[model samples]
Target: MSPNRALQRNISFYDATNPQEALGGVVQNGSITEANFLDILGILLVVDGVSPLRAQGRMSNHIVSRRDVPLKTGVYNIYCDASIQISNEPWIQRLVSRFAYREKDTFRREISNRDRKCVISGIVNPESSIQAGNWAGFKAAHIFPLEREGHWIQYDYGRWITDMDDAPRSSKISSSQNGILLLAHVHQVFQQYLISVNPDDGYKVVVFDLDRFGLDGKILDPLCRSPDDPHHASDELLRWHFRQSVLANMRGAGEPIFEHDFPPETDMVGEILAGHYGQERFDLDITDRLR
Candidate 1:
């Protein structure tokens, strides 16, 4: 059987951090660690259900060594091991309600005006509906996530924000260029890193989880990508988000998947603190929400 087919057949047993443990029976020649294992898995995920030739052409730019190499070869050559390091970083997503920022309304308005729809689902927001004050089921999601504002500032990620006039002086994390309009459900998946747009692959939407929204392989909406539009979402930010998604879902054993829904009177904080990387995540969530 072909290597790809062999890997696919035993995908359930595959472990990202220790590939040799699971793939030893199938791939006997080389040392496959988390680095190469994730690279291979990423290619498989990107090319799943896609024709080889088409996927190759689409992922050409991601080729590390030879631009002419086959899609699989190129993907295997690229070092995706950085994702492993990223997965170990102190990143966290906020689950509880956050303190409202005064500038958030302006940020939402700017994003809604620029995108005018769910960029992933292509669901349009009609002007008539807006005039009637019926704006529901839509949200402006932060690509970098508000919970990571500390990291954003420390890393000076605000340098990528070209449209910053509307952002608050304290931080450019609220820039419209860092936001995207998405359906309420789509927003949830995106925040959880279950879905992402691969900018290098012609902005193709990649679903890391079950594609219940029929969004896999869909192109990002052009409305949010026009070069002439000053408020268009940043490709740099999109790329960062895509990498995060890959690490969260493709790394060995993958990052811990948290349950966001809480029952009434449940100790949400206590539960979160008791989960994986709980103390760090809880601390970050509390710090950002109160800011």
Candidate 2:
């Protein structure tokens, strides 16, 4: 199906107390207005994907409420439904990575030093291995994607990086405060927005896609969230990512899931220009490539 068509389906909401009574449908563009109770409920209900059976189950078990939605003022407990399959489209990945490109040595070194293990999984990299300069199976994942540097700059998101000295005010996208050490595979799912950490919810790990790694509902590592730790990841950045994940996976039919494995000789530029957000993606790609 086309990306636009895949995102046009309606997301319905029903009363949890009486599942038979319909509350309403999601607003246009799948945005759930914060002020509207039903809209908030609808976002909570469908953010994890459109599964009537699961939605019904949650309501039946009182796992979610209709009249008294327990969501905090700005906190959201959202995830993409496991059923919304991710696509194997490598061009989109290339385009996004191009925008994310920067001098990696500093960011990677600082993040790896601070977070010696995957923050979510707690898989520690041995000190000996690190001394040998072997950082296999782990990566520094950005909380606010580097691809969205334009958004970051426009909003002055660099102000949130209080932990870093000499951090670039123009773009703190590569700062350790905006990064988390994650297992390589976990990093992929994170970059895809299929999983995210909800800092407002005590940094609980929320999975929008299938829980293949059993990471759903896990709390973020304390080592990374300790208040005394100057290098802790930014709560603002985490919240931003959580919100982005909600918009990407819960809105409408959910954002297209693009794969990241591009074979050699693939016409990545052509594919990106032909896909959703084509012009924006192409422009970002070109601008970043030029730099």
Candidate 3:
């Protein structure tokens, strides 16, 4: 559960030898332009900042495989290799925010104020407050959650993905634009669905839901609707619900879904801060600064 495990980063390579190569690299086909080149390099910079630099010198990194490149006038060629690079920057921030002192609480407040509903659920419980639960708080759910580990600190998913398999797709956890706040139950339910939503407009999005019972109440039903639109339950939310219910269909599977504590409920942030700063220092009382 330590953030040490969740930190991930990597850099990928692509062959620009032909149009097909560009398509495979980013799922797009076009004449590589200066802007596109900068975009690629910009992403590379992020990867380099987090991943180890290697001198390929023309050797293929072998991240991706061969793909098709089509040109105008009925011309097609396959002359480049598709590869991916990833890093664990955003993932680490998520872990830190989940476990960091003061950061978690403050983040929750910010998100709660934005959508008013629990990020995990579309409903906002009037009883929810920071002084109610362990810290008198409602849950500030992760759009992309941070799974647990040994001591329940904060683990990075990007790190896991990179280590388990070298891929360009990196884990996104922070980017305030990507999070939501929900009541505790709603948060639990959202976690159950393995899907999250945008309060402004219900967008059906997928998440790696790792729970047995889903957020809405029962096992997921792919034919159901998305949790979006508090008014009518959006299709996106329904799809997510169904997918999660199906995911929980482990009647014959060996690897059952695992359960662990998430933020607001667990004492991970408290423990991590207490261990780092000592309980005495953590409990210290302070006054105003500008006197």
Candidate 4:
């Protein structure tokens, strides 16, 4: 760790035993005094730099909703409107030395180059503004996971990538071609297969029952919408992801509890409603209002 790390950077570390559960301890309750925040980090971490600028930036940028302010900042107030996320900064060179891969990898940067921002949200800029020096908040999620059941490449899930019969498998199963670049929240839904892209149609999204998963279907962009983007997600990985989603959402009777998406007419109604109100709300239900 650097001398003034917490003062200048947002460092996210992983519990290598389980990267899925990593960084849950990130303090989302706004900034705290350096003393109250000391004991929460892992034993190997050194936590002492909750200075004004870091807290101010985290507050003004990453905070979702303003609440009771625990730490006193006489000059500036930190209020976050989006889900708290770690951004890159000059002061961010600290970590578990061995877990450097947790930092945005070459795979993620390549995906980001292709996808730009969260395809669904339609926001071109990050909340804090993408400073020339800072990294993006988008996460690169692997369609075929590298780890499962605390083991890598050894189990049934691993077999799906290595040994599936009908679908062609990628030689580099963990490459950028086997991934999707998504916002943090979208990544969460994508992780569960609540959101997916149709392999047949120009990669248009087919969200499976948004209501059941606490998400709403939106016009999500595929990885290869542009004319000249060299990299694109592999059909094999996407097929695997979609299959896993079906398995994940299937009921005990071996059937999906809900259908894949709203009908095209329903979407037409949604579009009409959105245009009429001059606002694109996802859950504008024609059935509920009966107008």
Index of the highest-TM-score prediction: 1
Residue lDDT tens for model 4, 66-122: 332343422222222322222211110011111112423666766666666666555
Evaluation by lDDT, superior candidate among 3 and 4: 4
User: Comparing 1 and 3 by TM-score, which wins?
Assistant: 1
Which portions of model 3 miss their true places by more than 4 Å? 1-103, 119-121, 125-137, 147-172, 192-255, 259-291
Candidate 1 local lDDT, residue 29: 19
- The total of clashing pairs for model 2 equals 2
Which scores better on lDDT, 1 or 2? Answer: 1
In model 2, where is the ten-residue run with the lowest total lDDT? 26-35
Quote each prediction's TM-score.
0.71, 0.69, 0.29, 0.40
Off by over 4 Å in 1: 1-103, 165-170
Each prediction's Cα RMSD?
9.6, 9.5, 16.8, 23.2
lDDT of 1 by residue, 18-56 (tens): 434431111211122233333534433332233221111
Residue 56 lDDT in model 2? 30
Model 1 steric clash pairs: none
Q: Residue 278, candidate 2: how far off, in angstroms?
A: 1.2
Model 2: colliding residue pairs: 48-81, 80-208
